[model samples]
Target: MAYYTSNAEHPIDIVNIASLENRVKARMDRGAFGYIREGAEDEWTLRENTRAFNDLRIAPRVLQGIDHVDLSTSIFGIDLKTPIIEAPSAAHGLAHVKGEVDTAIGAAKAGTLFAMSTYGSTPVEEAAAAAPEAPQFFQLYMSKDDGFNEFLIKKAVKAGVKAIIMTVDSTLGGYREEDIVSHFQFPLPMPNLAAYSASDGVGKGISEIYAAAKQDFVPSDIAKVKDMSGLPVFVKGIQSPEDAIVAIQAGADGIWVSNHGGRQLDGGPASISVLPAIAKAVNHQVPVIFDSGVRRGQHVFKALASGADLVAIGRPVIYGLNLGGAEGVKSVFDHLNMELSITMQLAGTKTIEEIKKTTLL
Candidate 1:
C-alpha cells in the first residue's frame, strides 16, 4: 500500500511553476519543503544549474513557412508525445497524499514517461497499477545486498517497466546544510525499501539510508542491470564526456546527463554546461536524457539544441503535485509542452528533429 492518508486541496489560480512553488512553501511543513527545495553545501551548482540556462540565447528563424509543430519523439523504442518526461524524485508522499501514484497518473495523462524512484513512498506494483497504460521506467539505487538487488529487479520487471534507470550518482549523501539545520527526516514510509529493516529508510536521514547502498558503482553495473532486467538500461547522473563514453562502452543503452539537481555535489559544473561536450562524446551512440534545472519551454529548446535527446523535469512536477495531486502533475507536463510548441513555432522549427539541429548562442 502507498503511504499517507489524504490529498491536498487544490490551490486556486496558480499561474506558473514559480508561483506554485511559492504556494507550496507557504503551506507545507518546513522540513519537508526544505528537503525538496534546498541543495548541497553552498549550493553553487544548484544555483548555477538555472543560471547557466539563462546565459544561453536562442536565435529564431522567421522564413521557414511552417504551419504545425510536432513534439513527438522516442527513447529506447518508446514514443513520447512530448520530449519532457518526469525525472524520479523520492518520497512524493511528502508533497502530496497520493504520492507517486498521483505522479504516475499525471505523467500518463500527459502522454509522457514517469520514472519511479527506489525510495518512492508507493510500492512499485501499486504505482504501476495506478497507471497501467503508462510507459514507466524504474530508477534504481543499487543496494549492497545482491539478494535485495535481485528482488527489486524482478519486482520492477513484473510491474512491466520498459527500462531500468540506474542512478550512478549519490553513492553517498551530500552535505545539505538545510537538512542538518532543520533536522529533517522522512516523515512517511518509503514502501519500496520496506524489505530491509535497517534500510526501510523512513524516519531517518538520507545519508543513513545511503550507507546501505552499494558504493562500488562502476560501469560494469550498467550491463549487470541490463542482464538483471532484460530491458534497456540508462545510466543516469552522468555529467562528463569521459564518463558518458565509459557508460556506453559498458553497454548502457542510454546516457542520462544530470547533476542530481545539484543535490549531490556543490561545486560541480551545471548539468547544462557539460551536456554539449558529453553529447559530442557519445556522438549519438545511444539516447541522451538531460535534466537538472529545466523550468520553461525555452530551457527545453536550449537543451535539445545543446545535445539532449529528451529533457526530464524534477522540482516543477513536485510543485504541481503539491498543489493539485495528479491534475497538478499533468498540468506541469501540459504547460511545458505548450511552451515547447510555442518556442518551436517561433523558432521556425516544426519538429523535434529540427530542434536538435538548432544551434544555441
Candidate 2:
C-alpha cells in the first residue's frame, strides 16, 4: 500500500529549499514525513552527505573580469540551461497528487533533466507525456525477472526517454525504522506496475523483482542494457573508486556517484566524500553524475567544482512537489539556477567548464 498524505493547511511561502522542506513537514503526517526524511538503519551516511559539504569551503575569485555567468551545459547530447537535474525519487503520491508527472512538467518548464524513478506512482508513459520535450531518463531497477526489466526499458524507449540509469545500490530494501515505527504502507494503484502487462509470469509487483534480485544484480547487467537497448546507460550508486572502475569496465556510459541518498546503507561514507576519487577514477571517460543531500545553490556549485558533470537533486525536488506540485518544483529549480549563477559570478567562474577543483579552497 502507498502512503498518500495530505498537503499543508496553508500555502507555502517559499524563501529557500529549507523553507519548502519545513512546509513538507507541516503538511505531511508522521509516517509520510518520516518515509522521506529517514535513512537506512542508524542513518550515519545520511547525515554525512550534508556534513561533507559543510567540511569544504569555496575559495572565491574576485575581479577576474566576469560580468555574467552562464550555467548552460549538456550531458549525453541533451542540452541543459543549468547544471542541475531533478534526481529520481519514487512514489510522489506521498508528496503531492500528481507525483512524478508534476515534477517532470516542472523540470521541462525549468529547462533541466528529470529522471523518473522506477517505482514512480505515475506510469512512465503518462509521466513522459507530461513533458513531451523535456529530456527524461528512465531509472531502472534490474528486476529479478529479466523480461520484466526489459519490458520497463521498452516502455521507456516507446515513451522517448533519453537514457537509462540502472541503480546499483538498493538491491534490498533499507532497514528504515522510521517507516516501520510509523507503519507507513505504500499507496495502492501503482501506475507503473498496473500499466506493466508482463504476461511472462510474475507474482504481484516490484517486490518480486527485488526479491529475485538480492544477490544476482551486477554491473554486467547494466552493460547489457547499453548493448541491447542502445541507450546511453549509467550505473547509479557508485561510492568508491573501485566501483567506478568496475562500472566503466562493464561498459557503463556514465557513473552516478550516490549512496542512494544515504537511504540504502547506514554508516557509509558520504556521497560527496567519495565523489572526488570516483570522478578521478573515471577520468572523464564518461559523465559523472552526482547526488545526495544537495540543498543549497552553493552545494550544487561544490558538486560541480569537485567533479560532477551534472548535479541531481532528490529531497528538494520532493519538497517542491509536496509544497505546490509543478509550481513548487519550478520555484525550486529557478532558485537553484539563480544560486548557481550567483556562485559563478562571485567565484569568478563564467561557465560550467570554468568550475573545477581549482575553484575550491
Top lDDT prediction, candidate number:
1
**Which lDDT tens digits does candidate 1 get at residues 289-334?**
9999888899999999999999999999888888888888888888
TM-score of each: 0.96, 0.92
How many clashes in candidate 2? Answer: 6
**Which regions in candidate 1 have their CA more than 4 angstroms from the true location?**
1-6, 9-14, 196-200
For each predicted model, how many residue pairs clash, with residues at least 3 apart or on different chains? 0, 6
Model 2 scores worst on lDDT over the 10 consecutive residues at 198-207
Model 1, position 121, has a per-residue lDDT of 86
Error of 2 at 1 (Å): 10
Residues 196-278, candidate 2: write the lDDT tens digits.
64332222333443565535667678777886577989899889999889888888899999998888888888998988888
